[model samples]
Target: MKPPTVFMGEMTNREVEAFLVDHQTVIVPTGSTEQHGPHGPLLTDVFVPQEVARRVAPRVGALVAPSINYGLSYPHVGFTGVVNLRIPTFMAVVEDVAASLATAGFTRIVFLNGHYDNTYAIAYACANAADRLPAGVRAFPINYWDGMTADEAGEFFGPTTGLHANRGETSAVMAINPDLVDLDHANAELPPFPAVTNAPAVHTAFFFSTPGSVHRASQSGTWGDAREASVAYGERYLSVVADATVRMLDDVERTFGAMPAR
Candidate 1:
């Protein structure tokens, strides 16, 4: 049988209800609208998760929610076209979305997040929403990058990866949407570590500079070399991640079924 088509923003309410009735799980792709060096498109971060959602949803009989295209990207504000939501606003959005899914009888809600900055905010939203959900309702916020192992990173990115607009991210974007990437501009630059590091800074206030200043801190907007990125390599890396996600969803579904009702 052909895989189910993901529900886009234009999907009707009746269609959404129909999918929920047939599927027990829902996947929400979250990404940021920010600069991704000079080579990758600003939408790269979002596209990775969205693509993963597109590939994985049908396998698990899950419906993909409309992608959350905007995220907390204040650190990249120095760059053009970067948009962000304050912590409070981001949390509210996550909470509202999760709560709405729970009310609609979606027992499993998986947040497929691609942006590093969204980690804590999405986690907080999931935790808070979980408390108010029905006993069987389950929600998980997961970072696509976090799902990879050190070995996987080493194999795919080697030694050059330095976070942000790095090799892995650049490769991912190229793999998913090569037409949007401008390889001629791909460059690598590593940021300097601060002498006096503050305790793990979580809020956007920690990095209030514009994208230009942020870019200035590094050799180039990119933290790792994207010159080696290839569509074939990207496909392999994506498969690894996608396989792991499928297993995790299965585990979550099984665990949810075994849990006692509230």
Candidate 2:
């Protein structure tokens, strides 16, 4: 038999009401619409999390909510097609979604994040939204990549995997949708980290100082090698993402109690 439609957008209102009768957990995919080098599409951040959510939804028997496509991309502001939401705006968006889910009877709102820059914004939004959530409702924000070790991630995408438009992410996009990647034109460029101390002033100057923006640090809009990215590697990485997400969902269920009989 075919798998049931787990996407919230694909289900009817009545279907959702009925779904909530058995399932009290909802997975929200949070991502960004920004430049992902020349090889990766602008929607790379958005698509990766959504795909990962879809893969794990069935295992957890949870509904995958409509994704929050735009996120805080201030670091990539100077890049073309990069639309960065202000911190407040991004926080509001996440809070609103979590509130909506809780109001709709979801006991647990799990946000699967893909954008590295959205880390603190998501955490702050969830913490602030806790008071707004009804009793028994809680929000959990997490990144799918966090399941893997830093060394493992670096191995797949090169050492600069933490940066934007790297090999691992490009390979993931390739695995999900080969048509979106232009491997032939892919470039490898790792911007130099500032030679300053561990002081906040130096760090702020590098990221917040418009004179040394992301574009200025890396001219090709890429941070690591994408030329070596391959569909096979992407498939492996995506499988890892799916497995890791499912493991996390398992933990959530264990911590929150399976479905809660809502």
TM-score of every prediction relative to native: 0.84, 0.88
lDDT of each: 0.76, 0.84
Name the 10 consecutive residues with the lowest summed lDDT in model 1: 197-206
Give me candidate 1's TM-score against the actual structure. 0.84
Across 25-143, the per-residue lDDT of candidate 2 in tens digits comes to 89999999888898899989889999999998888878999999998778787778888888899999999999999999999898999986788789999999999999978798888
lDDT per residue (tens digit) for residues 1-262 in model 1: 5344676454677777887767768889998898887788888878888888888888988888887888888776666778888878988888889998888888888898988778888988999888878886878887775556678757655335656666667777778978888888887776665555442342234454343445456545677777777777678767877876786676666876788877
* Residue 19 lDDT, candidate 1, scale 0-100: 76
